[model samples]
Target: MVTTPRITPDLSTNVGALRLAFPTLMASGCYGSGEEYAPFVDLARIGGVVLKSVTRFPRLGNDAPRLVPVASGLLNAIGLQNPGIDAYLERDVAKFAERPCAVVGSVAGFSVDDYGYVTERLAARDEIDAIELNISCPNVAHEGETFACDAALAERATRAARQATTKPLIVKLSPNVTDITEIARAVEAAGGDALAVVNTVRGMAIDVERRAPMLGNVTGGLSGAAMRPIALLAVWEVAAAVRLPIVGQGGIETARDALEFLLAGASAVSIGTANFTDPRAPVAICDGLSTYLNEHGYAALRDLVGAANPTFLGTR
Candidate 1:
């Protein structure tokens, strides 16, 4: 069921099928150890591997200057800590379970039975294929961004994390919204198969010579490259109000900024603070999207996903 990223830019396929390898992934708590940046690159040629939020217990996060720097990006609140959920199924489930790609597992909490006890304890493990329901933990201190800005508490925490698994859940939306399409149609009417639009944008910085606030938990979560145009205008307004499938991430670093969230509809993409400034930035964004599709003859990579929405329903 997992065929070598299905020939060029598979970025690993299967969202409902769940495989995946080429849509170029990585955003969950920003690569703490996708093989520790694999000594500078080669995370299975991009399209899978999203760990770092594991929790149902261990977490010692938040402290230090925690992180803060602006004028284009950088402000974190490192609170989802980690190392919980039975030591993340014991030290990152067998080192990303015999790697190759596709590992997604980013959970986090604050109710709904702690997101169904960490989604039935990481879906009883198979080395997780998908379950990224962080629900945007904006530096905790009161259960991340108000249960991700309402939407009926984001559809009761995405239907208690979709009755705690069968894999593939992905609901991470929370750009401190006012209406992120009412929390991405309330996690696609409480079943959520995909929607990782954004998860960092609450900001704050003021170290005016030690004059207070600059992280250390005073409010953070800015992300890089000045959050590329508000994360591509919220992945082009939630990929024209959801039909599902979107993995875009804020301030992507290249491959033409991951083809501008796949021409504003995003079926896949996430680089996050250029992996701390380009540890081979996703193999230079997969060789700059295969040289921008061999100089535009355009072929694979889902043939340019969304293909640039045309005004997406005039002035909404």
Candidate 2:
């Protein structure tokens, strides 16, 4: 009897200086530092784990009705609620270090100094594999405008964080900007090691009966399937504009959805809102991606990166 050989494609990839075992990461704010879903899935099997956003000080977040379900997506105004970086380092960092996967720390701030302070501290921690700067949060220092929407401000923030940390810096871009590539170029020029395109798009919903906004914050970040197309376009545009790797995410719920981002030039993909429904989604997608590569005759996962680009195919 002859047995068939099992084919395993290389799923490893790099996002800036950090190397990942796979290309599917658990998006920030989805896994909550990989504690909540530890029992449901094998966190080690996934590519990386991006923890929830933390600040220098603890945040109470928005009022009631922070998360609202929308058509094919979710609207959330969590306001970067976290227990502060000091608390996270003292309590959670040790647990995170025990995990086999790469651990990424997500930091949000109200000022440039705030970004630098948090990043400098996290960079000193050997457990943190990388730092993701969440500049999409409303900048209280800039009249409530998100730093990511302003190229100059974004560059300054990225530069401050870059100077504060030797660890790989991944800036999370906002899709609410007029032109995403402008922000992408600014980050790259400011010394960002990579980009995560993007954070959720700004959107809102109204309660017809009450005639009021469903979210207490009036507007919330739109995530899930509703934002995939926007994410794909942003990744495609940024890929053309900069030479940095990208972690493309929006509404990725399955392996095929992840494949779209890779074909558009993403070095990796992140699973976010989908985790709300399925705790095992990221791991499942990883398995499916390996299956896709083997069945499609692709030698490795990196071979699919930017495969759909005309220039890459010599058709442009």
Candidate 3:
């Protein structure tokens, strides 16, 4: 008898009105043009898709030496290069608006107004379901990092962004912090609806002969399997402290990886670096999770959320 992964899910539910087949989703910057990847895999199969970070204005990003290969992962200073908000709406965002799957727009800016102005522009458009704030863009300005690292500054930026739009706000926090909980709470107090934790850790590499940094930007954010444990831990800490829903992501290459985030208190999970490894990663995860659920007798994906939390690990 031939058998296949079942798309049917009884546990099809979520933290709010957002019901999902499984908690799997694609990380921002992972999936290329929706129109481009459409041939490789069904982007809509996942819970949602976070578009690459857009800015208030178009950016060409950094110089040629922007990507470097590290032992465990890839370091990138792509510089959030994208056409400004207007071109994005006319081009990328408009394309996805026709799809039934949730479209999460990711944004970045150099200053407080950069963030707020971007949000306001997105709010005026109904094409996106939510906005994922990339306060942790590691490539360009030191200012973006400043907002992400300081608790007070993080709060101020979040509050300003929150005031700009009524859309669901999800703040992506950097993993470089010693205490992620402090930043998470600040977002909650400032009215962020959800969180996408642990943005890639900052790192650098050197070219021996050139005696210069490998990446044109000198340093960049690291993403891939190497960041899994740190990402999981950060998600766990933030989830435990904040009541907001979380979209856990980083190095999620397989179904088990997605489950790890769900157990860590993430309402949904995002696939980042793995996409570079396998373009079909997100669809594979969606199908893999459905099979896991049907085999385990769980009715829906929601039932699995936090079921594997350490608090539930050793039971009599």
Candidate 4:
């Protein structure tokens, strides 16, 4: 008797207009420009890279002790460090043209107009496949995460960035808000193409010996395995509240963690703090996801998306 061959499961998924070959993206800030991890992993095998957030002007970032390793996670107050939009456009964007995977530019700003200016400048580049409006960065001072916390502010910022560029606009929301779903709805109404749920949870650490806060900024954004549960719930809620695709993040470190987000309703999972522990985690996740799909008799990654959520309202 002849046996039939089993076909490999498809890992492809769509984030707005960007069709990712894989449903795993190297989260912004942690992965840099994808150049840092080029030596350790094959870029083409993963989905894409959300480049570090660029602002309208240069920032010195937080002082020393910006990172503190806490129980099951990390506390970071990097302050959205970048060379600013003008310098970034002049020296950085050209390098992304050769990246094997899609390049999504991240823009962070203090005000609505700032989001528009930086987003327009970055998305104008042919090298950038999409734009991630980082309205939820907790590390920065002067209400950086304010846009994501307030529904009206989120709408204004998304609208401003939407008017700036025709590229796919992904609004990154904050988990520190009172109601993340409300903000998600506002963003969708403001023309956002997708949503990156749960940036980082606001937290802090103290050193008794030094009699001071562990992080220079006093408060920091917490990420890693610790924030996984919070991020997952945010993704589930946002997925039910809006029809836009969701890129779930926070403290994902392994295939199981990524799988949890997908089941919760994220179309894709962004790897962040996990890279610090293991650079090969992204590739491993892709392999593990394929195995899980095949073992469960699923045909593609999209099949697993929102599998556990009854009220999921995404496009898939």
Candidate 5:
């Protein structure tokens, strides 16, 4: 008996109009400007890099003792430290043109106006292929994550940014909310082209010796293997609630971990804490995904999206 040759699996995907050669993206704040990892990994092999978030003004970030090691994850309170948007546009934006893959600029803000202003300036850069509106950074004080935790606020922030630029907008959502789906639906209605389901979960650590909080800020965002289940559930729920594409993140490491998110209905997967362990983790995941697809007689990565979730409403 003769068998037909299997075709190579197609891994390409799109976040709005921004085409990614692969479904792997370097999560914002995890991989500094793509330049930092070029020496350790092949930039062309991956999809893109979501640059560290920039605010309307420069920030000093949180104080010392910013990172704490936990049982299966890490807690951090980085506070979105970065040069102001003006300096970023003058000094940083130009360098992104040299990157081999897509460059997505991340914008963090304290108000709807901040989101709109920063997004307009960042998205206007020719080097920026897309925008990741970071409305859910829990590391910062009071207003940082408030936009994502409330449905109406989330919609207003998304709409403000949406009106600022035609660039593809990916709204990052918070897992700390009571009903994540409500916020996801609101963002979609507000014109978000895609959704980044589940940023790091809010957590804290204590110092028995000092009898004080481990993190200088007292509270931090938790990420790594411990949050995989939570992130997966958010992706599943959000995918079922909106038709936009979803980028699943939070605590992903191995190929199996990434696969779980795709099967649950994520159109793509963002690599964050995993990069801290291995810079080449993204390449490894792509290789593993190809092997799995061939073994299962699948023709493309999109075929696996939403495969395990019957209620999934997003497109593959």
Candidate 6:
């Protein structure tokens, strides 16, 4: 009897002080606190689960019609609607802690103090493996001017969070900037452990028949396959600028998309909007990645990271 060869590719990775069993993570806001997806996908199959951004106070989010479907993407102005940090810690943290995978808590605020407060609170929770600072939300403080839009502001925010927590800090950056590398370097210098490159791009949709906007917020963040190229560029630029690990994400929908991000310089990849289309997308990508690694004679996932870089290939 002929037997199939056992394929076991090392998919482990490290982001600063935090080590993951795999290289694919469920993006923030895509999987809530993970309870919602527990009935659908295997929560422990992926590297980590990043919870949705939680504020100091419960939010009602924007008005009606917050999500709209585009050709190759989704436009959403959900406004970070979530229960306050206290509620999350009291009700959700334990649930996530019970899981056998890494749990990454996400925090967002309107000011430095707000960021610091949330970070400090989450740092006390042993259940949380890391903290993802969401500095890219477009409808937040400073008259909707995201902290990621300015290098100085990004550094200030990172500094505040760093002082507040000893947990691994992953700063999520915005793509709506003049030079993303400046913000990336500032975050790294300010003690950020890792970076999550290319948050949803700001975009708008209209209802021609109604002569109005489609999203309630008028302008929403665009995500899905449409943002992959822009996300790749951001990862390429930021990876070249900082020595810190990167969690690249944008419109990743398959294993091939995740591979592109890794080759571009991401230590790990985050599956976002694709989760909405296929509940099993993350697990499928993980399985497919293993197959690709074995077929290509790659011993580990890290071997593929930044493989496309000219400097890494000695082609520059």
The model with the greater lDDT, 2 or 3, is: 2
Task: Tell me the deviation in Å of residue 110 in model 4.
Answer: 0.9
lDDT of 2 by residue, 263-298 (tens): 888899989999999988888888889889887888
TM-scores of the models, in the given order? 0.33, 0.96, 0.90, 0.96, 0.96, 0.95
Clashing pairs in 3: 10-299, 10-300, 11-299, 11-300, 11-301, 12-300
Clashes in model 1: which pairs?
Answer: 10-22, 11-21, 11-22, 11-23, 12-20, 12-21, 12-22, 58-84, 72-226
Q: Report how far residue 226 has shifted in candidate 4, in Å.
A: 0.4
**Model 1 lDDT on a 0 to 1 scale:** 0.77
Q: Compose the digit string of candidate 1's lDDT tens values, residues 1-316.
A: 8543322333344555566657777888788748888777777787776788776788898887888768777899988788788867866677777767788888878776788788788877886778888866432544454777888877887898899786788888877788898888878899888888787888888878989987887987898889788878987898788677788888888888888887777777777777887778887888788767756666566667767776442121
lDDT of 4 at 42: 97
Put the candidates in lDDT order, highest first.
4, 5, 2, 6, 3, 1
Backbone collision count in every prediction?
9, 1, 6, 1, 1, 0
Cα lDDT listed for each candidate = 0.77, 0.89, 0.78, 0.91, 0.91, 0.88
Indicate whether candidate 1 or candidate 6 has the larger lDDT: 6
Tens digit per residue, CA lDDT, model 6, 1-316? 9865767999988888888998888899888777788899877788889889998889989986999999899999998898898888888787766877798989898887878999999878989999999987433556776788888788988999999999999999999998999999999899999999978999999999999999988999999999999999999888888888999999999999999989988999998899898989999998988999988988788888889965332110
Q: What local lDDT score does residue 287 receive in model 1, on the 0 to 100 scale?
A: 79
Quality of model 6 by C-alpha lDDT: 0.88
How many clashing pairs in candidate 1?
Answer: 9
